[model samples]
Target: MLAVTILGNNSAVPAFDRHPTSQVVTHDGVNYLVDCGEGTQIQMINYKIRRGKISHIFISHLHGDHYFGLVGLLNSFGLLGHQQELHVYAPSPLQEIIEMQLRVADTRLCYQLHFHTISGEALLVDNEKIEIRCFPTQHRIECYGFTFREKRKPRKLILDSVKQNNVPLHFYDNLKDGEDFITSAGEVIRNEWVTTAAPKGKSYAFCADTRYFEPIIDHIRDTDMIYHETTYLDNLRERAFERFHSTSKQAALIAKKANVKRLLIGHFSSKYDTLEEFEKEARDVFPNTDLALEGVTYRI
Candidate 1:
């Protein structure tokens, strides 16, 4: 199963009821931490998220609200005696900050730490079952949005067809790979006779932090689920643009244009007391929109 759990959803500041940016994406058994804002570790504990399952972290930008908790989380990992390697993907400047913190504390991690710097749009990470790609977003400080796509498997071969045709077992792999089979008797067997194409897999897009930008539509088109930042309602649209952020309406418009099945919006401004307006504004543009709540899990 592929899902995402919101740890923090507030923008810029942490209020008593809301927090900054943070979420946990779980695909299969692996957990990925996206944007570790302050108090994220506590949020993880509060939500009963298994810290040991997190194998990777993705930071969208250099904003304090996006990655202030990263050092603390890394320190906690060491204190907890985690031995698995952890991979972090972020801008190049983050490496220095993390290294300085580790130096000042004279602490050494028990596991290997791998850092990958994202310098431009479209960074790809391929695993066995999942593929994650990062694209540039129109934020003030070099922000990025990520898309997670499940790899589509090749079609299954029909063993009954192979047997009925007396086809060689070794050629079964070829059929699954969509290749026509040539029998020993010089007869060509069509791939459709033995196999059918697999169904398309699901995809999730995370528009971490951004203003209303048209180029993002192409990157997130046809996603199964999309998480976009809606830091304010339509009334606060001017403030959102001044701060290089997005309003609820803008996020929904992106989802609508991208043809995403569902939209999850959060990163609300601290000034708002209730999220009812945010939901109303977004749903007006895209009916399939939902307000992202902390500790709530969303299936992609």
Candidate 2:
């Protein structure tokens, strides 16, 4: 399963119980932390997320609101006696920042911390289970958006037909790989006759803080779902551009242009406590938009 759990949604400062920008993307039992904002670990604990399952983290930028909780979370991992290597993908300067804090306190982690600097559009992870890639976003400083794509799943077996035909259990793996099964009596059973095609792989895109930009459409086009920041209302479009932030309508336009299956909008400015208007403004343009509520899990 490919899903994203929102931990914090508010931008800059915490308000209305919203902390900062943090999310957990889970696929096939592995969790990827997208942005480590302040109080991230606490949010994860409150949400019943297994911190031990997180082996990779992707920070969109070095802004404090975006990544202030990273060092604390890493330290907590060490305290928890987690021995697996931790991989963090972010800007190159983040390595120095993390190292300085570790140095000052004379801290030593039980596991290795590998920092992979994202430069422009780069593929971060590619394995049998999942694929992750990053693309540059139009923020004030260098920032990036990440896309997670699940690998194709195995073909499903026809239980009744397989049982009736006496197909051996050991051949199940072969059948899932689309190989024809041969019975002991020399009768060949076609793979499709007893197995269904694999399910379509799901994909999710996380677009971090950015101004109204068009190039982003290419990076997140046609995704199963996308999380885009809508930091302000349409009336403040001028202010949003000055601050390198996006308005609700602007984010919706991107979702509409990209033809995504669904859109999630969050990162609200602390100026407004009530988020009903944000949803109304986005849905007006893109009907499939949803508010990114804290602690909610959005399945990709």
Candidate 3:
């Protein structure tokens, strides 16, 4: 599993019972916070997300709605006696901003907080299980989008075949790793005869806080799912362009052009009391589009 849970979906201000921008991307039992907007902690608690499990956080920009809750969340982590080291990736200015806030409060977290500045296209994280890369997005200020790709899993063991081959239980792990089994009779049991190919890993992209950026299509191309911002309805295309924001149709167009498996639109403007029109317009172009409602989990 690869999945994303929407914590806050509104833009600028929280309104119409919606929150600001924040979300959690979960992969292989690890959680990656995409943004920490206002009230993000509250949303996490309400959704039963374990804050302690979050080892990394990615902030797209310095916009208040994008990261206002980060300080509070870190404070709460310290108060909660969290001892795990946490890594945060964002623009360089954010390090100074956070340090200033912590300094003013004379606050020091119990856990070590590492900050990695994102300036352009960069590989933020790479491990045996996952790869995370960031790319710049067109915005009024510095901003970035992220792509999460899961490494392929090991081969799956067929219980009956393994048992038939007289493979010992202790060697099950080796079989899963595609190693041939050596039986007590000194017979070589082929790995493929007892194991099957693993399922293909999934990929997800988060196109955070951008205008109608055409260049972004290359970064998000052929992803299993995409989370794009739709701060306004299609009718307000000009206004959206002027404000360096995106309309639902524009988001859909990007998804369509990128050939993503699915598109999720959110970061709705507080001006719109109803969201049905936003969903309708995006789906008009990309039929697989869905609204990124708060607390909802969309699997990739």
Candidate 4:
């Protein structure tokens, strides 16, 4: 159930029916929002994203395109009577910015709102079901990328083996935890003999606005999938580098170098009227690349 729904994928400006940078990473019914660009609320409504399920929001940078819709969304949450405690993680100065906006409007939220200032690479959230961490990205301003990893599942029990071994019901839990079982007579049964290892947890990384930075490969290596910004086509490599952005080929190169299972490229520049060439160019280098189309849900 680990997936990300793209709300707005365009970069800087919204054009050609595309919005700004925003998305929702959904895992096991809980939603973690990443970036709140302009028109984020409208895009969420268009995509049918359950705003109530979002308990945490991660803003990558201070750029207007990345956070212009944040205060509005927060205000809407109050108006909508959202009851869950809300947590926001971002770099410095965002708390000050949000407070000023809230103060000017004199809007009092009904629910508890928490803001966490991200300092360098650190673990943001680690609960029973998921672990989320942030790493720095090479953006024009201070920016960060986020990694969402599902917690490793418990080992599955072999019903026949447990029944044949006469293992007590109370010992089942221990077996699932990969613990060896001992009988009253001091007979030891290996955990592997009664249970199979659970599947490895799925993982996804949101590589917020960045250039062709190789250091990023270290943090995103071997992820199930990653959404990297391809702000320009291959021919505009120079322009992308100058703008602190990445081209389609560059994004694909990152995915290939990181050994990710799949790559989702978005954050397209407004100059491009069509995206077919972007996908084709990226796929040339990384066959598993796909366009991060708005309103599309990509399962990791």
RMSD of each: 1.5, 2.3, 2.7, 0.8
Residue 110 of model 4: what lDDT? 96
- Residue 77 of model 3, lDDT score: 97
Off by over 4 Å in 4: none
In candidate 3 the C-alpha lDDT for residue 243 amounts to 86
Per-candidate total of colliding backbone pairs: 0, 0, 0, 0
Which scores better on TM-score, 1 or 2? 1
By summed lDDT, which 10 consecutive residues of candidate 2 come out lowest?
A: 159-168
Q: Write the per-residue lDDT of candidate 4 for residues 1-300, one digit (tens) a residue.
A: 799999988999899999999999999999999999988999999889999999999999999999999999999999999999999999889999999999999989999999999978999999989999999999888999999999999999999999999999988988988999888899998899999999999999999999999999999999999999999998989999998999999999999999999999999999989999999999999999999999999988
Error of 4 at 201 (Å): 0.7
Model 1 — which ten-residue stretch has the worst lDDT? Answer: 119-128
Clashing pairs in 2: none
Encode model 3's per-residue lDDT on 191-251: one tens digit a residue.
9999998988899999999999999999999999999999999889899898889999999
TM-score for each model: 0.95, 0.91, 0.90, 0.98
C-alpha lDDT values of all predictions:
0.91, 0.94, 0.94, 0.94
Record all residue pairs in model 3 with backbone atoms less than 3 Å apart, i.e. clashing.
none
Candidate 4's displacement at residue 42, Å, is 0.9
Candidate 3 versus the native: TM-score? 0.90
TM-score of 4: 0.98
